[model samples]
Target: MSLIIIGSVAFDAIETPFGKTDKIVGGAATYASLAASYFCKNVKIVGVVGEDFHQNDIDTLNQHGIDTTGLQIKAGEKSFFWSGKYHNDMNSRDTLVTELNVLADFDPILPESYQDCEYLMLGNLAPQTQQTVIKRLKNRPKLIVLDTMNFWMDVALNDLLETLKLVDVLTINDEEARQLSGEYSLVKAAKKILTLGPKYLIIKKGEHGALLFHEDQVFSTPALPLAEVFDPTGAGDTFAGGFIGYLAKVGTINFNNMKNAIVFGSALASFCVEKFGTERIINLTEEEIAARVKEFVKLSSFNIA
Candidate 1:
Protein backbone atom coordinates (compact mmCIF):
# COMPACT_ATOMS: atom_id res chain seq x y z
CA MET A 1 0.00 0.00 0.00
CA SER A 2 1.25 3.48 -0.88
CA LEU A 3 0.28 6.94 0.33
CA ILE A 4 -0.05 9.90 -2.04
CA ILE A 5 0.15 13.52 -0.83
CA ILE A 6 -1.06 16.52 -2.84
CA GLY A 7 -0.21 20.10 -1.85
CA SER A 8 2.19 22.99 -2.39
CA VAL A 9 5.97 22.72 -2.41
CA ALA A 10 7.60 26.10 -1.83
CA PHE A 11 9.79 28.39 0.23
CA ASP A 12 8.68 30.28 3.32
CA ALA A 13 10.10 33.11 5.44
CA ILE A 14 8.78 33.25 8.97
CA GLU A 15 9.15 35.53 12.00
CA THR A 16 7.88 34.99 15.51
CA PRO A 17 8.28 36.49 18.97
CA PHE A 18 10.80 33.73 19.67
CA GLY A 19 13.02 34.37 16.62
CA LYS A 20 13.15 34.51 12.80
CA THR A 21 14.34 32.69 9.71
CA ASP A 22 15.55 34.04 6.35
CA LYS A 23 13.92 31.60 3.93
CA ILE A 24 13.36 27.90 4.49
CA VAL A 25 12.03 24.97 2.52
CA GLY A 26 8.39 24.72 3.65
CA GLY A 27 5.05 23.73 2.19
CA ALA A 28 2.12 21.37 2.82
CA ALA A 29 3.57 18.44 0.81
CA THR A 30 7.12 19.04 2.05
CA TYR A 31 6.26 18.58 5.72
CA ALA A 32 3.65 15.93 5.07
CA SER A 33 6.01 13.76 3.08
CA LEU A 34 8.76 14.08 5.72
CA ALA A 35 6.53 13.23 8.65
CA ALA A 36 4.87 10.32 6.88
CA SER A 37 8.23 8.81 5.93
CA TYR A 38 8.71 7.85 9.57
CA PHE A 39 5.85 5.34 9.47
CA CYS A 40 5.80 4.30 5.83
CA LYS A 41 8.63 4.33 3.28
CA ASN A 42 6.77 4.54 -0.03
CA VAL A 43 5.04 7.93 -0.30
CA LYS A 44 4.14 9.59 -3.61
CA ILE A 45 4.09 13.40 -3.58
CA VAL A 46 2.27 15.61 -6.11
CA GLY A 47 2.81 19.36 -6.29
CA VAL A 48 4.14 22.23 -8.42
CA VAL A 49 7.41 23.99 -7.79
CA GLY A 50 9.59 26.22 -9.99
CA GLU A 51 13.07 26.10 -11.46
CA ASP A 52 14.35 28.07 -8.47
CA PHE A 53 13.31 25.33 -6.02
CA HIS A 54 16.21 23.37 -4.56
CA GLN A 55 16.90 19.99 -6.11
CA ASN A 56 18.70 18.91 -2.95
CA ASP A 57 15.42 18.93 -1.05
CA ILE A 58 13.84 16.76 -3.72
CA ASP A 59 16.83 14.42 -3.57
CA THR A 60 16.46 14.18 0.22
CA LEU A 61 12.80 13.19 -0.02
CA ASN A 62 13.51 10.66 -2.75
CA GLN A 63 16.32 9.17 -0.67
CA HIS A 64 13.85 8.81 2.20
CA GLY A 65 11.61 6.71 -0.11
CA ILE A 66 9.28 9.52 -1.21
CA ASP A 67 8.51 9.30 -4.93
CA THR A 68 8.68 12.76 -6.52
CA THR A 69 7.92 11.40 -9.98
CA GLY A 70 4.66 13.36 -9.82
CA LEU A 71 6.33 16.57 -8.56
CA GLN A 72 6.13 19.25 -11.27
CA ILE A 73 9.14 21.53 -11.59
CA LYS A 74 8.17 24.35 -13.94
CA ALA A 75 11.25 25.59 -15.79
CA GLY A 76 12.41 29.22 -15.70
CA GLU A 77 9.95 30.30 -13.02
CA LYS A 78 10.18 31.09 -9.31
CA SER A 79 8.55 28.77 -6.79
CA PHE A 80 5.63 29.86 -4.65
CA PHE A 81 6.75 31.91 -1.63
CA TRP A 82 5.09 33.00 1.61
CA SER A 83 6.33 35.24 4.41
CA GLY A 84 4.52 35.69 7.70
CA LYS A 85 5.02 37.08 11.21
CA TYR A 86 3.60 35.16 14.12
CA HIS A 87 2.05 36.71 17.20
CA ASN A 88 3.27 36.12 20.76
CA ASP A 89 0.74 33.34 21.30
CA MET A 90 2.35 31.45 18.42
CA ASN A 91 -1.08 30.45 17.17
CA SER A 92 -1.94 33.42 15.00
CA ARG A 93 0.08 35.23 12.33
CA ASP A 94 0.01 37.99 9.74
CA THR A 95 0.86 37.24 6.14
CA LEU A 96 3.35 39.83 4.91
CA VAL A 97 3.86 38.42 1.42
CA THR A 98 2.46 35.69 -0.79
CA GLU A 99 3.78 35.06 -4.30
CA LEU A 100 1.79 32.46 -6.18
CA ASN A 101 4.46 32.27 -8.85
CA VAL A 102 4.12 28.95 -10.69
CA LEU A 103 1.32 27.89 -8.36
CA ALA A 104 -0.95 30.72 -9.58
CA ASP A 105 -2.14 28.55 -12.42
CA PHE A 106 -1.16 25.10 -11.16
CA ASP A 107 -2.97 22.19 -12.78
CA PRO A 108 -1.71 18.99 -11.18
CA ILE A 109 -1.35 16.05 -13.58
CA LEU A 110 -0.66 12.75 -11.85
CA PRO A 111 2.16 10.78 -13.40
CA GLU A 112 1.36 7.24 -14.60
CA SER A 113 3.24 5.74 -11.66
CA TYR A 114 1.18 7.81 -9.17
CA GLN A 115 -2.15 6.40 -10.32
CA ASP A 116 -1.98 3.20 -8.23
CA CYS A 117 -1.67 4.82 -4.78
CA GLU A 118 -3.99 3.39 -2.10
CA TYR A 119 -4.08 6.27 0.39
CA LEU A 120 -4.77 9.74 -1.00
CA MET A 121 -4.20 12.86 1.10
CA LEU A 122 -5.43 16.05 -0.51
CA GLY A 123 -3.56 18.87 1.15
CA ASN A 124 -4.91 22.41 1.21
CA LEU A 125 -5.30 23.44 -2.44
CA ALA A 126 -7.90 24.49 -4.95
CA PRO A 127 -10.87 22.14 -4.54
CA GLN A 128 -11.05 21.63 -8.28
CA THR A 129 -7.41 20.61 -8.35
CA GLN A 130 -8.08 18.05 -5.64
CA GLN A 131 -11.08 16.77 -7.58
CA THR A 132 -8.94 16.38 -10.65
CA VAL A 133 -6.61 14.06 -8.71
CA ILE A 134 -9.49 11.96 -7.46
CA LYS A 135 -10.74 11.55 -11.00
CA ARG A 136 -7.36 10.35 -12.22
CA LEU A 137 -7.20 7.57 -9.65
CA LYS A 138 -8.15 4.28 -11.32
CA ASN A 139 -9.33 2.77 -8.07
CA ARG A 140 -10.84 4.52 -5.06
CA PRO A 141 -8.40 4.60 -2.17
CA LYS A 142 -9.18 2.76 1.07
CA LEU A 143 -9.48 6.18 2.68
CA ILE A 144 -9.30 9.70 1.31
CA VAL A 145 -8.40 12.48 3.77
CA LEU A 146 -8.69 16.15 2.88
CA ASP A 147 -7.13 19.21 4.46
CA THR A 148 -8.54 22.63 3.65
CA MET A 149 -8.34 26.18 4.96
CA ASN A 150 -10.78 29.05 5.35
CA PHE A 151 -9.19 30.79 2.36
CA TRP A 152 -10.75 28.23 0.02
CA MET A 153 -14.03 28.27 1.88
CA ASP A 154 -14.20 32.01 1.47
CA VAL A 155 -13.31 31.97 -2.23
CA ALA A 156 -14.80 28.68 -3.45
CA LEU A 157 -17.48 27.29 -1.21
CA ASN A 158 -19.26 25.38 -3.94
CA ASP A 159 -16.16 23.60 -5.14
CA LEU A 160 -15.00 23.02 -1.57
CA LEU A 161 -18.34 21.45 -0.74
CA GLU A 162 -18.07 19.24 -3.80
CA THR A 163 -14.60 18.05 -2.74
CA LEU A 164 -15.84 17.32 0.77
CA LYS A 165 -18.41 14.94 -0.68
CA LEU A 166 -15.65 12.87 -2.30
CA VAL A 167 -13.56 12.55 0.86
CA ASP A 168 -13.95 10.29 3.91
CA VAL A 169 -12.18 12.56 6.39
CA LEU A 170 -11.91 16.34 6.58
CA THR A 171 -9.26 18.13 8.68
CA ILE A 172 -9.43 21.83 9.49
CA ASN A 173 -8.57 24.21 12.29
CA ASP A 174 -11.03 25.44 14.95
CA GLU A 175 -11.95 28.70 13.22
CA GLU A 176 -12.55 26.94 9.92
CA ALA A 177 -14.86 24.49 11.66
CA ARG A 178 -16.88 27.33 13.17
CA GLN A 179 -16.99 29.28 9.95
CA LEU A 180 -17.96 26.24 7.93
CA SER A 181 -20.67 25.15 10.33
CA GLY A 182 -21.75 28.55 11.65
CA GLU A 183 -21.82 27.07 15.15
CA TYR A 184 -19.83 28.44 18.06
CA SER A 185 -19.72 25.26 20.13
CA LEU A 186 -17.37 22.69 18.67
CA VAL A 187 -19.70 19.83 19.50
CA LYS A 188 -22.51 21.52 17.61
CA ALA A 189 -20.12 22.58 14.91
CA ALA A 190 -18.90 19.06 14.27
CA LYS A 191 -22.45 17.87 14.16
CA LYS A 192 -23.38 20.51 11.62
CA ILE A 193 -20.30 19.90 9.52
CA LEU A 194 -20.85 16.13 9.53
CA THR A 195 -23.96 16.87 7.54
CA LEU A 196 -21.72 18.48 4.96
CA GLY A 197 -20.41 15.04 3.83
CA PRO A 198 -17.26 13.75 5.56
CA LYS A 199 -17.83 10.76 7.84
CA TYR A 200 -15.01 11.88 10.13
CA LEU A 201 -14.06 15.41 11.22
CA ILE A 202 -10.73 16.45 12.68
CA ILE A 203 -10.54 19.94 14.17
CA LYS A 204 -6.90 21.02 14.58
CA LYS A 205 -6.43 23.47 17.46
CA GLY A 206 -2.68 24.23 17.21
CA GLU A 207 -1.47 24.58 20.81
CA HIS A 208 -4.68 23.11 22.15
CA GLY A 209 -4.29 19.68 20.49
CA ALA A 210 -6.97 18.20 18.23
CA LEU A 211 -10.46 16.75 18.38
CA LEU A 212 -11.74 13.76 16.42
CA PHE A 213 -15.45 13.29 15.86
CA HIS A 214 -17.34 10.47 14.15
CA GLU A 215 -21.02 9.87 14.42
CA ASP A 216 -21.89 10.14 18.15
CA GLN A 217 -18.36 9.40 19.36
CA VAL A 218 -15.67 11.99 20.14
CA PHE A 219 -12.04 11.85 21.27
CA SER A 220 -9.65 14.60 22.33
CA THR A 221 -5.87 14.56 22.23
CA PRO A 222 -3.72 17.13 24.08
CA ALA A 223 -0.82 18.90 22.47
CA LEU A 224 2.51 18.60 24.21
CA PRO A 225 3.41 21.78 26.10
CA LEU A 226 6.81 22.58 24.67
CA ALA A 227 9.24 25.05 26.21
CA GLU A 228 9.49 26.80 22.85
CA VAL A 229 7.60 26.75 19.54
CA PHE A 230 9.96 27.88 16.78
CA ASP A 231 7.52 27.58 13.91
CA PRO A 232 3.96 26.26 13.50
CA THR A 233 3.75 26.78 9.75
CA GLY A 234 3.25 23.20 8.53
CA ALA A 235 2.29 21.42 11.76
CA GLY A 236 -1.22 20.70 10.52
CA ASP A 237 0.02 19.09 7.35
CA THR A 238 2.54 17.12 9.41
CA PHE A 239 -0.30 15.90 11.57
CA ALA A 240 -2.16 14.71 8.51
CA GLY A 241 1.02 13.02 7.33
CA GLY A 242 1.35 10.97 10.49
CA PHE A 243 -2.35 10.25 10.58
CA ILE A 244 -2.42 8.73 7.11
CA GLY A 245 0.99 7.12 7.49
CA TYR A 246 -0.09 5.09 10.49
CA LEU A 247 -3.23 3.93 8.72
CA ALA A 248 -1.22 2.87 5.68
CA LYS A 249 1.25 1.04 7.91
CA VAL A 250 -1.51 -0.81 9.74
CA GLY A 251 -3.56 -1.35 6.56
CA THR A 252 -6.87 -0.50 8.15
CA ILE A 253 -9.16 2.43 9.05
CA ASN A 254 -11.18 1.08 11.96
CA PHE A 255 -11.74 3.29 15.01
CA ASN A 256 -9.09 1.48 17.03
CA ASN A 257 -6.56 2.01 14.26
CA MET A 258 -7.64 5.63 13.90
CA LYS A 259 -7.16 6.16 17.63
CA ASN A 260 -3.55 5.05 17.31
CA ALA A 261 -3.11 7.15 14.17
CA ILE A 262 -4.21 10.25 16.08
CA VAL A 263 -1.61 9.64 18.74
CA PHE A 264 1.04 9.10 16.09
CA GLY A 265 0.03 12.31 14.33
CA SER A 266 0.15 14.32 17.56
CA ALA A 267 3.61 12.96 18.33
CA LEU A 268 4.89 14.00 14.90
CA ALA A 269 3.31 17.45 15.24
CA SER A 270 4.97 17.95 18.64
CA PHE A 271 8.36 17.62 16.98
CA CYS A 272 7.31 19.90 14.10
CA VAL A 273 6.71 22.96 16.33
CA GLU A 274 10.03 22.44 18.10
CA LYS A 275 12.04 23.73 15.13
CA PHE A 276 11.72 25.93 12.06
CA GLY A 277 9.69 24.55 9.17
CA THR A 278 10.37 20.81 8.67
CA GLU A 279 13.73 20.73 10.43
CA ARG A 280 12.90 18.50 13.44
CA ILE A 281 10.61 16.09 11.65
CA ILE A 282 13.23 15.43 8.96
CA ASN A 283 15.70 13.75 11.33
CA LEU A 284 13.25 12.19 13.78
CA THR A 285 13.73 8.57 14.82
CA GLU A 286 11.22 5.80 15.50
CA GLU A 287 12.52 5.27 19.05
CA GLU A 288 12.08 8.98 19.83
CA ILE A 289 8.60 8.99 18.29
CA ALA A 290 7.49 5.90 20.24
CA ALA A 291 8.75 7.57 23.44
CA ARG A 292 6.62 10.64 22.72
CA VAL A 293 3.54 8.56 22.00
CA LYS A 294 4.07 6.80 25.32
CA GLU A 295 4.20 10.23 26.96
CA PHE A 296 0.90 11.19 25.32
CA VAL A 297 -0.72 7.96 26.52
CA LYS A 298 0.37 8.74 30.06
CA LEU A 299 -0.72 12.37 29.83
CA SER A 300 -4.24 11.41 28.82
CA SER A 301 -4.58 8.24 30.90
CA PHE A 302 -6.69 8.09 34.04
CA ASN A 303 -8.86 5.68 36.04
CA ILE A 304 -12.34 7.06 36.48
CA ALA A 305 -13.69 4.10 38.40
Candidate 2:
Protein backbone atom coordinates (compact mmCIF):
# COMPACT_ATOMS: atom_id res chain seq x y z
CA MET A 1 0.00 0.00 0.00
CA SER A 2 1.21 3.47 -0.87
CA LEU A 3 1.37 6.28 1.70
CA ILE A 4 0.73 9.91 0.82
CA ILE A 5 2.22 12.78 2.91
CA ILE A 6 1.15 16.38 2.63
CA GLY A 7 2.93 19.36 4.27
CA SER A 8 5.65 21.95 3.74
CA VAL A 9 8.95 21.11 2.07
CA ALA A 10 11.16 24.15 2.49
CA PHE A 11 14.21 25.79 4.06
CA ASP A 12 15.14 26.33 7.70
CA ALA A 13 17.90 28.03 9.69
CA ILE A 14 18.40 26.44 13.07
CA GLU A 15 20.47 27.30 16.14
CA THR A 16 21.15 25.24 19.26
CA PRO A 17 23.70 24.91 22.04
CA PHE A 18 25.68 22.51 19.85
CA GLY A 19 25.96 24.68 16.72
CA LYS A 20 24.02 26.44 13.99
CA THR A 21 23.30 26.18 10.29
CA ASP A 22 22.68 28.83 7.66
CA LYS A 23 19.95 27.05 5.78
CA ILE A 24 18.99 23.39 5.47
CA VAL A 25 16.24 21.43 3.83
CA GLY A 26 13.71 21.12 6.68
CA GLY A 27 9.95 20.99 6.83
CA ALA A 28 7.11 18.84 8.15
CA ALA A 29 6.81 16.86 4.93
CA THR A 30 10.58 16.58 4.49
CA TYR A 31 11.11 14.91 7.86
CA ALA A 32 7.96 12.75 7.68
CA SER A 33 8.72 11.54 4.17
CA LEU A 34 12.29 10.65 5.09
CA ALA A 35 11.33 8.84 8.30
CA ALA A 36 8.50 6.92 6.60
CA SER A 37 10.67 5.84 3.66
CA TYR A 38 12.60 3.42 5.88
CA PHE A 39 9.49 1.38 6.76
CA CYS A 40 7.21 1.64 3.71
CA LYS A 41 8.07 1.10 0.05
CA ASN A 42 5.77 3.30 -1.97
CA VAL A 43 5.99 6.69 -0.20
CA LYS A 44 4.68 9.66 -2.14
CA ILE A 45 4.84 13.30 -0.99
CA VAL A 46 2.46 16.09 -1.95
CA GLY A 47 3.68 19.61 -1.13
CA VAL A 48 4.95 22.88 -2.59
CA VAL A 49 8.48 24.19 -2.80
CA GLY A 50 10.16 27.03 -4.66
CA GLU A 51 12.39 26.99 -7.72
CA ASP A 52 15.24 27.88 -5.37
CA PHE A 53 14.93 24.44 -3.79
CA HIS A 54 17.80 22.38 -5.16
CA GLN A 55 17.06 19.54 -7.52
CA ASN A 56 19.68 17.51 -5.63
CA ASP A 57 17.57 17.60 -2.46
CA ILE A 58 14.63 16.29 -4.48
CA ASP A 59 16.92 13.61 -5.84
CA THR A 60 17.94 12.73 -2.29
CA LEU A 61 14.32 11.93 -1.49
CA ASN A 62 14.14 9.89 -4.68
CA GLN A 63 17.21 7.98 -3.51
CA HIS A 64 15.20 6.86 -0.50
CA GLY A 65 12.35 5.49 -2.73
CA ILE A 66 10.03 8.45 -2.12
CA ASP A 67 7.97 9.51 -5.15
CA THR A 68 8.12 13.26 -5.73
CA THR A 69 5.73 13.41 -8.67
CA GLY A 70 3.24 15.36 -6.60
CA LEU A 71 5.76 17.95 -5.30
CA GLN A 72 5.04 21.29 -6.93
CA ILE A 73 7.96 23.60 -7.63
CA LYS A 74 6.71 27.16 -7.86
CA ALA A 75 8.69 29.02 -10.46
CA GLY A 76 10.50 32.24 -9.44
CA GLU A 77 9.08 32.23 -5.93
CA LYS A 78 11.03 31.47 -2.80
CA SER A 79 10.30 28.45 -0.65
CA PHE A 80 8.98 28.97 2.85
CA PHE A 81 11.83 29.65 5.33
CA TRP A 82 11.97 29.46 9.11
CA SER A 83 14.67 30.30 11.62
CA GLY A 84 14.56 29.18 15.22
CA LYS A 85 16.84 28.88 18.23
CA TYR A 86 16.58 26.21 20.88
CA HIS A 87 17.02 26.84 24.59
CA ASN A 88 19.54 25.01 26.77
CA ASP A 89 16.85 22.47 27.69
CA MET A 90 16.35 21.59 24.01
CA ASN A 91 12.64 21.17 24.69
CA SER A 92 11.72 24.82 24.15
CA ARG A 93 12.53 26.96 21.14
CA ASP A 94 12.03 30.53 19.93
CA THR A 95 11.21 31.49 16.38
CA LEU A 96 13.49 34.14 14.89
CA VAL A 97 12.14 34.30 11.38
CA THR A 98 9.35 32.97 9.20
CA GLU A 99 8.96 33.62 5.49
CA LEU A 100 5.86 32.14 3.96
CA ASN A 101 6.61 32.96 0.35
CA VAL A 102 5.39 29.84 -1.38
CA LEU A 103 3.41 28.56 1.58
CA ALA A 104 1.30 31.71 1.90
CA ASP A 105 -0.95 30.61 -0.94
CA PHE A 106 -0.30 26.87 -0.87
CA ASP A 107 -2.93 24.87 -2.69
CA PRO A 108 -2.13 21.16 -2.56
CA ILE A 109 -2.76 19.56 -5.95
CA LEU A 110 -2.74 15.79 -5.57
CA PRO A 111 -1.69 13.88 -8.65
CA GLU A 112 -4.25 11.32 -9.76
CA SER A 113 -1.79 8.58 -8.85
CA TYR A 114 -1.68 9.71 -5.21
CA GLN A 115 -5.43 9.70 -4.78
CA ASP A 116 -5.68 6.04 -3.82
CA CYS A 117 -3.00 5.54 -1.21
CA GLU A 118 -3.97 3.36 1.74
CA TYR A 119 -2.42 5.69 4.31
CA LEU A 120 -2.47 9.48 4.47
CA MET A 121 -0.50 11.78 6.84
CA LEU A 122 -1.57 15.38 7.05
CA GLY A 123 1.39 17.09 8.61
CA ASN A 124 1.23 20.50 10.31
CA LEU A 125 -0.29 23.01 7.95
CA ALA A 126 -3.25 25.32 7.61
CA PRO A 127 -6.39 23.46 8.67
CA GLN A 128 -8.05 24.47 5.41
CA THR A 129 -5.22 22.95 3.41
CA GLN A 130 -5.40 19.69 5.32
CA GLN A 131 -9.15 19.58 4.86
CA THR A 132 -8.79 20.31 1.17
CA VAL A 133 -6.59 17.26 0.69
CA ILE A 134 -9.05 14.97 2.45
CA LYS A 135 -11.89 16.31 0.33
CA ARG A 136 -9.86 15.87 -2.85
CA LEU A 137 -9.32 12.17 -2.22
CA LYS A 138 -11.76 10.14 -4.30
CA ASN A 139 -11.75 7.37 -1.71
CA ARG A 140 -10.93 7.76 1.94
CA PRO A 141 -7.63 6.19 2.96
CA LYS A 142 -7.69 3.24 5.31
CA LEU A 143 -6.02 5.41 7.96
CA ILE A 144 -5.76 9.18 8.16
CA VAL A 145 -3.46 10.76 10.78
CA LEU A 146 -3.25 14.46 11.38
CA ASP A 147 -0.55 16.49 13.15
CA THR A 148 -1.32 20.02 14.24
CA MET A 149 0.07 22.68 16.56
CA ASN A 150 -1.22 25.28 19.02
CA PHE A 151 -0.93 27.89 16.31
CA TRP A 152 -3.75 26.33 14.34
CA MET A 153 -5.89 25.82 17.41
CA ASP A 154 -5.46 29.45 18.34
CA VAL A 155 -6.25 30.83 14.90
CA ALA A 156 -8.54 28.29 13.28
CA LEU A 157 -10.28 26.17 15.88
CA ASN A 158 -13.43 25.65 13.82
CA ASP A 159 -11.58 24.55 10.70
CA LEU A 160 -9.22 22.37 12.68
CA LEU A 161 -12.15 20.69 14.40
CA GLU A 162 -13.83 20.19 11.02
CA THR A 163 -10.70 18.53 9.63
CA LEU A 164 -10.34 16.35 12.74
CA LYS A 165 -13.71 14.78 11.93
CA LEU A 166 -12.35 13.41 8.66
CA VAL A 167 -9.23 11.85 10.15
CA ASP A 168 -8.90 8.50 11.92
CA VAL A 169 -6.03 9.55 14.19
CA LEU A 170 -4.82 12.83 15.59
CA THR A 171 -1.24 13.55 16.79
CA ILE A 172 -0.46 16.55 18.92
CA ASN A 173 1.78 17.48 21.80
CA ASP A 174 0.57 17.62 25.43
CA GLU A 175 0.09 21.40 25.40
CA GLU A 176 -1.99 21.39 22.26
CA ALA A 177 -4.10 18.55 23.57
CA ARG A 178 -4.99 20.58 26.65
CA GLN A 179 -5.79 23.61 24.55
CA LEU A 180 -7.97 21.67 22.13
CA SER A 181 -9.97 19.84 24.78
CA GLY A 182 -9.83 22.39 27.62
CA GLU A 183 -8.80 19.70 30.07
CA TYR A 184 -5.64 19.66 32.16
CA SER A 185 -5.55 15.89 32.37
CA LEU A 186 -4.46 14.30 29.10
CA VAL A 187 -6.83 11.36 29.65
CA LYS A 188 -9.74 13.74 29.98
CA ALA A 189 -8.45 15.71 27.01
CA ALA A 190 -8.29 12.59 24.90
CA LYS A 191 -11.85 11.71 25.81
CA LYS A 192 -13.09 15.20 24.96
CA ILE A 193 -11.08 15.27 21.74
CA LEU A 194 -12.39 11.82 20.77
CA THR A 195 -15.91 13.21 20.80
CA LEU A 196 -14.85 15.62 18.05
CA GLY A 197 -14.26 12.56 15.75
CA PRO A 198 -10.85 10.85 15.55
CA LYS A 199 -10.83 7.29 16.86
CA TYR A 200 -7.29 7.61 18.23
CA LEU A 201 -5.16 10.32 19.84
CA ILE A 202 -1.37 10.43 20.21
CA ILE A 203 0.00 12.96 22.67
CA LYS A 204 3.68 13.55 21.94
CA LYS A 205 5.63 14.65 25.03
CA GLY A 206 8.92 15.36 23.25
CA GLU A 207 11.94 13.97 25.11
CA HIS A 208 9.71 12.47 27.79
CA GLY A 209 7.94 10.08 25.35
CA ALA A 210 4.56 9.64 23.61
CA LEU A 211 1.18 8.42 24.81
CA LEU A 212 -1.44 6.66 22.69
CA PHE A 213 -5.09 6.67 23.84
CA HIS A 214 -7.90 4.69 22.22
CA GLU A 215 -11.27 3.96 23.77
CA ASP A 216 -10.51 3.21 27.42
CA GLN A 217 -7.04 1.83 26.71
CA VAL A 218 -3.71 3.68 26.89
CA PHE A 219 -0.14 2.86 25.86
CA SER A 220 2.92 4.81 26.89
CA THR A 221 6.27 4.72 25.08
CA PRO A 222 9.42 6.25 26.55
CA ALA A 223 11.98 8.30 24.67
CA LEU A 224 15.46 6.90 24.54
CA PRO A 225 17.83 8.69 26.88
CA LEU A 226 20.96 9.99 25.19
CA ALA A 227 24.16 11.74 26.23
CA GLU A 228 22.95 14.81 24.45
CA VAL A 229 20.20 16.20 22.24
CA PHE A 230 21.93 18.32 19.61
CA ASP A 231 18.74 19.64 18.02
CA PRO A 232 15.04 19.00 18.38
CA THR A 233 13.67 20.23 15.09
CA GLY A 234 11.61 17.81 13.00
CA ALA A 235 11.63 15.16 15.74
CA GLY A 236 7.86 15.25 16.17
CA ASP A 237 7.22 14.91 12.45
CA THR A 238 9.68 12.03 12.34
CA PHE A 239 7.74 10.30 15.09
CA ALA A 240 4.50 10.72 13.16
CA GLY A 241 6.15 9.28 10.06
CA GLY A 242 7.45 6.21 11.85
CA PHE A 243 4.10 5.68 13.58
CA ILE A 244 2.20 5.58 10.28
CA GLY A 245 4.99 3.89 8.35
CA TYR A 246 5.01 0.86 10.62
CA LEU A 247 1.23 0.61 10.43
CA ALA A 248 1.29 0.82 6.64
CA LYS A 249 4.00 -1.83 6.39
CA VAL A 250 2.07 -4.26 8.57
CA GLY A 251 -1.32 -3.34 7.00
CA THR A 252 -3.15 -3.54 10.30
CA ILE A 253 -5.20 -0.99 12.30
CA ASN A 254 -5.58 -2.25 15.84
CA PHE A 255 -4.58 -1.04 19.31
CA ASN A 256 -1.83 -3.63 19.76
CA ASN A 257 -0.27 -2.72 16.43
CA MET A 258 -0.53 0.97 17.23
CA LYS A 259 1.34 0.40 20.48
CA ASN A 260 4.20 -1.13 18.49
CA ALA A 261 3.99 1.72 16.00
CA ILE A 262 4.47 4.19 18.88
CA VAL A 263 7.64 2.39 19.93
CA PHE A 264 8.96 2.40 16.37
CA GLY A 265 8.12 6.06 16.07
CA SER A 266 9.82 6.93 19.35
CA ALA A 267 12.90 4.99 18.27
CA LEU A 268 13.13 6.90 15.01
CA ALA A 269 12.52 10.20 16.77
CA SER A 270 15.31 9.40 19.21
CA PHE A 271 17.68 9.36 16.27
CA CYS A 272 16.33 12.67 15.01
CA VAL A 273 17.41 14.63 18.11
CA GLU A 274 20.99 13.31 17.97
CA LYS A 275 21.86 15.77 15.25
CA PHE A 276 20.66 18.91 13.54
CA GLY A 277 17.68 18.83 11.19
CA THR A 278 17.54 15.55 9.24
CA GLU A 279 21.25 14.81 9.38
CA ARG A 280 21.00 11.78 11.69
CA ILE A 281 18.08 10.13 9.88
CA ILE A 282 19.23 10.53 6.26
CA ASN A 283 21.74 7.68 6.14
CA LEU A 284 20.44 5.36 8.91
CA THR A 285 20.90 1.71 8.07
CA GLU A 286 18.37 -0.99 8.83
CA GLU A 287 20.79 -2.51 11.29
CA GLU A 288 21.01 0.77 13.19
CA ILE A 289 17.24 1.11 13.33
CA ALA A 290 16.86 -2.48 14.51
CA ALA A 291 19.42 -1.98 17.20
CA ARG A 292 17.78 1.25 18.33
CA VAL A 293 14.41 -0.43 18.49
CA LYS A 294 15.98 -3.14 20.65
CA GLU A 295 17.12 -0.39 22.98
CA PHE A 296 13.54 0.80 23.30
CA VAL A 297 12.34 -2.71 24.16
CA LYS A 298 15.01 -2.94 26.84
CA LEU A 299 14.16 0.49 28.17
CA SER A 300 10.50 -0.34 28.73
CA SER A 301 10.21 -4.09 29.02
CA PHE A 302 9.33 -5.69 32.36
CA ASN A 303 7.33 -8.62 33.69
CA ILE A 304 4.93 -8.05 36.54
CA ALA A 305 3.64 -11.16 38.27
Q: Top TM-score: which candidate number?
A: 2
Off by over 4 Å in 1: none
Model 1 residue 62 lDDT score: 89
TM-score of each: 0.98, 0.99
Q: Against the true structure, candidate 2 has what lDDT?
A: 0.94
- Tens digits of per-residue lDDT for model 2, 1-305: 89999999989999999999989999999999999999999999999999999999999999999999999999999999999998998888899999999999999999998977999999999999999999999999999999999999999999999999999999999999999999999999999999998999999998789899999999988899889999999999999999899999999999999999999999899999898899999999999999999999999999999
Scored against the true structure, residue 179 in model 2 reaches a CA lDDT of 96
The C-alpha lDDT values of all candidates are 0.91, 0.94
Worst 10 residues of 2 by lDDT: 204-213
- The Cα error of candidate 2 at residue 217, in Å, is 0.4
lDDT of 1 at 202: 93
Q: How far off is model 1, as Cα RMSD?
A: 0.9
